[model samples]
Target: MLNSTQVSYFTLGAYFDTKQVKYVLFLILLCLYVLIVGSNVLLIMVICVKRSLHEPMYMFLCSLFVNELYGSTGLFPFLLVQILSDVHIISAPLCFLQIFCLYTYAGVEFCNLAVMSYDRYLAICHPLQYHALMSLKKVALFIAAAWITAFLIVTTTTSLSFSLPLCGNFINKVYCDNYSIVKLACSDTTVNNIYGLISTALVVFVSVGLILYTYMRILKVCFSGSKQTRQKAVSTCTPHLASLVNFSFGICFEVLQSRFNMSSTPGAVKVLLSLYYVTCQPLFNPVMYGVKLSTIRSMWKRLFWVKLK
Candidate 1:
């Protein structure tokens, strides 16, 4: 729905004039979204039902999957529709909701990763007091804290992101995104850009950096001891490590590409980069968690009608 006042720009290479190609792409995206939802839901179900997975580490991973579903669903479906229809119109209120959902999930995902990393650090570095320190009640408290922190971060980002007036109507990207959304605002976004920088630093530099430092210490402890201890440490933390690397790699790329790369990018590069966040992210989480953890794989098998009995 385009108003008389708002100026809408046509994004090249995605004109929805052709019926066949649009429908085909829509079908493909719908399948991918279904696959993502199904996989993450199965991951959650397996963790809940399987007695073997009721541990601190898997709990963190379960939360991560849930948040991933939240983040991906926020934009991917709408984006698919926009691309298929070749209409990029979005109402102002709906755009705010999109930012809220995306920011919440992203913040929660960051906190959950940090929490998992710390849990691994404790388990690997302190074999003796691990049980007492990472008890069920303590894990619950940590999750609660993560949720609260995520809420606050989301509140701040949303308040700032959405409060700006939208005199200029069009968002440049495929979905309701931070960069594209900000560019549509009527006012100067210097402060918003600064906040974006801070947010990126907080996630990539502060949270992941500390996690890496802890993992390094944990690795030191693992390699110094007996062979069995080394193997066990690697086994316990490997899934988490993989997830951290997989997740952080994309985020770091986003930060650098947005902030540092001063070159003028073409439309194809924009779509490809945006697809990394939307399409690649959901797929990565399931593969990393499901493949790395045997329990999750069994659950995933059961989910897809594979007989486990």
Candidate 2:
């Protein structure tokens, strides 16, 4: 049994031999990383620079886009490198750091979505008081709270996983995972497991509960209110609903993959399932919002036209 200190590097057991296809995979992932970075940064810039988009919804979106960038950057670069490298090993500190980055990214993503749902509830259900309710200060505070809460949660998780003395350093996934690390512990993991369950429940239930509650209120308004009210709810809430559903599916798959034995599953499928949440959500949100939101669409078109001119 190797002590945590003796386990200087963790071998990722998931990467099979890519051989000649490695270059193709590398290029594909590189392009994906570039697109994720470019699209998200553009959206963030548009929101930040345009005074018309200074409202609470767009402010929350800016935070969401920023998180997409953060999360994608955490995985894509390492993935690109690993795809090309023969040795699929990550240093202990880097592994833990990746675990921290990706975990917090997931946490922040859920919390940000929850906050956006609340913002929508205010906009649709309380139009008259929406501005008063979701002022710039409150928006800032909400965004801060979302990010800070995720940071604190993932920080504790990563710290606990990092301190464990590992019997083995082989992770059966493409990237560093906190649960996988806990499973490698030579010492008792009662604390880690207990904390993991508590934190997971806290984040999932609270975020999902808030989203459900807000949407219920929004639906109530749409049903009883005028046609304009219904249209408003449909227009604003559709993209959010789509994003939430897509993200939830991805996270569910990831959680299942991490916790359960899926050894019988094909390697490629397993890899795709593991990468889906991190890759797809970031790619999905920008495109979804850009296409779905009229104001953002118009602004994006105008910006493109100006650039062309």
Q: Write the per-residue lDDT of candidate 1 for residues 1-309, one digit (tens) a residue.
A: 332134333232223354677777778788888988998887887888888889988888788888879888997777776866645677666766786887677677778878888888888788799989999888988888877877776677767766666555555456556675566567778888898778767754677787888888887987787887787777667777776666666665555555455357665565566556546777778777788766666666766675645
Query: Candidate 2, which segments miss by more than 4 Å at Cα?
Result: none
- After superposition, which runs of candidate 1 have C-alpha atoms over 4 Å from their true positions? 1-19, 186-190, 256-266, 297-309
Candidate 2 has its poorest 10 consecutive residues by lDDT at 157-166
Best candidate, lDDT? 2
| Worst 10 contiguous positions by lDDT, candidate 1 | 7-16
Task: Estimate the TM-score for candidate 2.
Answer: 0.98
Residue lDDT tens for model 2, 96-188: 899989999999999999999999999998889999998999999999999999999999998888878889988999999888899899999
TM-score of 1: 0.85
TM-score of each: 0.85, 0.98
Give the whole-model CA lDDT for all candidates, comma-separated: 0.72, 0.93
Question: Residue 285 deviation, candidate 1, in Å?
Answer: 1.8
